[model samples]
Target: MLRIKRLDIFIVKSFLLLFIGTFFICLFIFMMQFLWRYVDELVGKGLEMSVMAQFFFYSALTLVPVSLPLAVLLASLITFGNFGERYELLAMKAAGISLLKIMRPLIILVCFICVVSFYFQNVIGPIAQGKLGTLLISMKQKSPELDIPEGVFYSEIPDYNLKVGKKDRKTGMLYDVLIYNFKDGAENAHIIYADSGKMEMTADKQHLYLHLYSGELFENLKSQNVKSQNVPYRRESFREKHTIIEFDSDFNMADASIMSNQATTKSMGTLKASIDSMTHYGDSIGRQYFKEAMGGAYSQPSGLSKNDTLRIAEANIASYNVDSLFEAATLMQKQKIISSAVSRTGSLQGDYSFKTYTLETNDYQIRRHRIEWHKKITISLSCLLFFFIGAPLGGIIRKGGLGMPVIVSVLVFIIYYVIDNSGYKMARDGKWIIWMGVWLSSSILAPLGFFLTYKSNNDSVVLNADAYISWFKRIVGIRSVRHLARKEVIIHDPDYSRISDELNALTARCRAYVNTHPLRKIPNYFKLWMSVGEDNEMKAINEQLESLVEEMSNSKSVTMLTALNNYPIIAVTAHVRPFHIYWLNLLAGVIVPVGLFFYFRIWAFRIRLSKDMERIIKNNAEIQDIIKTNNNL
Candidate 1:
């Protein structure tokens, strides 16, 4: 049995509070996005409140899998950020608790969340998606509420266009209405002009009732005698007329079975069954097509085997010339033969085209089912991957609240979204393998999570801007001038004799190294990269130079300290090779572009090194001269 620690409880409670809040916030955001995509279908359908409630509820359920990973990322980031900002993490570490130890409870929590995500994706998500899809189709099929504006034609009614010149708002009456009816075809249209009319829906809301006070109606009549020159029609005037138009305003839910075959409406088990069935179906169709191609047009003639046909063709090979035979034939016979060949070719082409289309459709469905099957597992794993990344990153940055965490989370999530979406499209289009495309985002982010966790656990300065800046400076050979100020209080005075001897030895070493190495000449390319060793002579010279500067700094003289500041800070191993490992150096050398870049970079460093050595020699001579002058005084 495992005992629960107070520390674990505290960590878990803090994470849960934040997780609940972030989860809902993320859910609402995704739901709003879903609503925006189908807003047009829902806007004018006049759906009931209960229907809308179901719409959003089902939408939330369908969006849960997408929202969970982002929620985990943000919550973990804020939780760890708060810990680091308040120095709570520092205290825990001081008390001998490791970062990984403190994160143990949350890791377990995230794993549970992953399990829940998978369950929702495989079980709950499909049902909700089916319901949502059915609801959307019903909404789109439902007629818009009847509202005819003044001076505009309303075409919302089927087969009719009505324009109202004016209306009475209180009485719900129309004035100067013009209506066109094309129910009997446009050629036999009916045109009506009504002085006043009122429109209302029937009790069942399945038909529209139109009552006109005074109107003139013109109806076109189709002529029975085709040869007659005169067209016939009818005109009638009515003081009161009632017309019924077929308009169904009542909301009727569509058949949910219509969406049952959709890939989004299937669970993992169903998806596997569907994929197997479709694959078998596709394979059978492929084999049928192959058999037809082999036997239909390309087969030997009736009662003749392939070998018999080949033997007969070989015997007649020299006796028949198709071009000469065509020239010997009558023109009409040649035309008949050409027409027959063209007809046969067209029939065969159409048949094969139909078969190809059928196979492609079946194969596409199989890919969809396979893609959905892999999606259930990949999306769940992303939740765990995101937590490791967020927790360590938050600890490294040491920021809390919404400001920094929100920005970082958004950027990271955007990267994940882009990679995941691109891979999804690629896989769906069959441009990439199903597993590789679906797993692309997880593969890319797994290493990042590991790297951040390792860096944060070791308390490394991975996120420090100064560290990167220093590295960039070193890479570009940008050296800094040393600054040494005179001390007002000194514990020990410098011995001019000892400093003088050291400076002479350092200057002699620098001159000898610079002279022998010939830094201005180009180095051997192979030796520069493949050979790996530090320049011990330059290393010893730099050490001695620094020591001499330290001893001379205690002098009371201001000029002596000023001369000490001019000594250049030498990069010990820069001029030798790009990396310490021989393989890495060889890799850089093998790739021409990369090798060329490093080669020129090393050459520039060599030039800088030569200048640095000259400066060291000059600074040494100046200090030695100052020491001699002081000794005489």
Candidate 2:
């Protein structure tokens, strides 16, 4: 028990180390992006440095959910890889520690992480985003320093264009400033050519002043009366404020986006307001429908029978009147009132149907948001899945190197990420049920991880080289034998009257042919060809014999008899029924007999040539002996 505890402690520690490292690494990368995005905006607006810092801080907080799952997966992979490398898992297994036992502490750690992630998602994340939005909004109104270079037109405004020949940066003095103003159809609208100008902020910085010196403004009026008169000219000084010019409304609180859900949860009052809004809209629709049913209530009124019973019944629904005419008119007016109410009620009912449909749509959205609301927790739980994947994969591979495991882990993670992200999109788009889309990836990989883990735990050799190796061994252990006819051979007594003389003669002939003629150019002394097995070689040799037979037939000079002399080969090959296991009773036919004949013929020719040389040597020696004998005589 103590030893098991120690192992669990070690595994947990490793997981924590890897998890924390990946978390910080991913956090740092996201933080850098957050800084880059807002830093320039802050500087451009001349906002206080503190605002930029706050922006980055809050932005980083919002990005946590996206980074957490990726970090968890990376961490689990590294942790398990380390264990597999050090052989600690092997050691634990040898000691009879079950896989489930090893996973106990890890699962507990995942649960703890999941809880923390949930808290972060629900609490810290929304608040941080809200604060970030507020900070950016506050900075948008601030005026930035304008460094207008000489001899270039600066179009910072949407419709107006300005060019300054030169400017003193320190004094904010402008020289040779030219401003072009556009009009809704004023031909030659207006141009202000100033000798010099200077800019200054209002005491409260609510406005900017461009004071000009001795500059003439030209305006071309299209009116004939004005055109015939003197052209309009004036010395101009323009003043505008940041408020008059609209800046982007982008960086606002986005409170509606962030707080609606939070508000929905806080009190019944908030939900009641949304419900009431929907209810009110429903009532409006019902009213329209009711009015449509009433003849000409919502439409133009048409003259109809005033004495009709339904109209009369509805008409007399008023206080007493003077006479018949007045009484009828009053009654009709009263009927209209009742008709209006009925019309409103009918419209309200239709509006209610639409509202119900919309509410179902919203409900689907809310269910989908269960994942978004708990995104961090859900993503963090993926750590358990990854742990299963990494741990088992490491065991199966039994390799500790970063190269292979990292590649494998990345591939697995890519698949997981693709599925998860795809499901999320489908859910968001209402294409799939929220539960299926949000948890689909997890559902898939979790079981797969478990199966792989179970397999690894059982020490099942999922991939082994033995099966292939055994096949090769079987192939190597084969040999081939030619089918020899069962004609009995007996050595006949050296007399001609021997009964078995014919058999002996045939045996001698076959033996002489085998010995004298070698079909192959060179024999494989090692007989490694036999290692290829008898069946395969036999097949090959038979193919060669068949091909030789065809060649012999094509070339009439190359008879089977001549082939037997050149290439000595023999096979007791018999034909078998197609696709059948049974063999046919067939005699040992002469296959590639011509090749065997050539083989023996060459061997005999070479042997004879050697014997002839020996004879010459013997003759020379005999001649020498005879000469010696004669000389002695």
Indicate which candidate wins on lDDT.
Answer: 1
Q: Pick the candidate with the highest TM-score.
A: 1
Model 2 per-residue lDDT tens digits across residues 1-633 = 787788888888977887887788778877887777766666655544566677777777777765666566667666666666788778877888887787779878876777666556567776776676666656654445555568988665544567999888887878888877664344555677878877665555554456777677777655547446565444444442111322232333333354444421322333345545655655676576567545443333456454554555565545654456545666778688679889988987876687677656655545444546434445767766777777677666666545666677778878987998998888777788767888888899889888888887897766345655755543332223222222243242122123123323433443443455353344322231112222343344335444433332322222222322333232222111111121210111122354343334434443443343333234333433433453465
lDDT by residue (382-422, candidate 1, tens digit) is 99999999999889999999999999999999999999999
In model 1, where do residues sit more than 4 Å from their true spots? 1-4, 287-295, 298-300, 303-320, 478-633
- The C-alpha local distance difference test score for the whole of candidate 2 amounts to 0.57
Report the poorest 10 consecutive residues by lDDT, candidate 2. 580-589
- Global lDDT of each candidate: 0.90, 0.57
lDDT (0-100) at residue 428 of candidate 1? 90
Deviating ranges (above 4 Å) for candidate 2 = 31-43, 133-151, 157-160, 167-173, 181-190, 200-203, 211-215, 219-231, 235-377, 397-410, 460-633
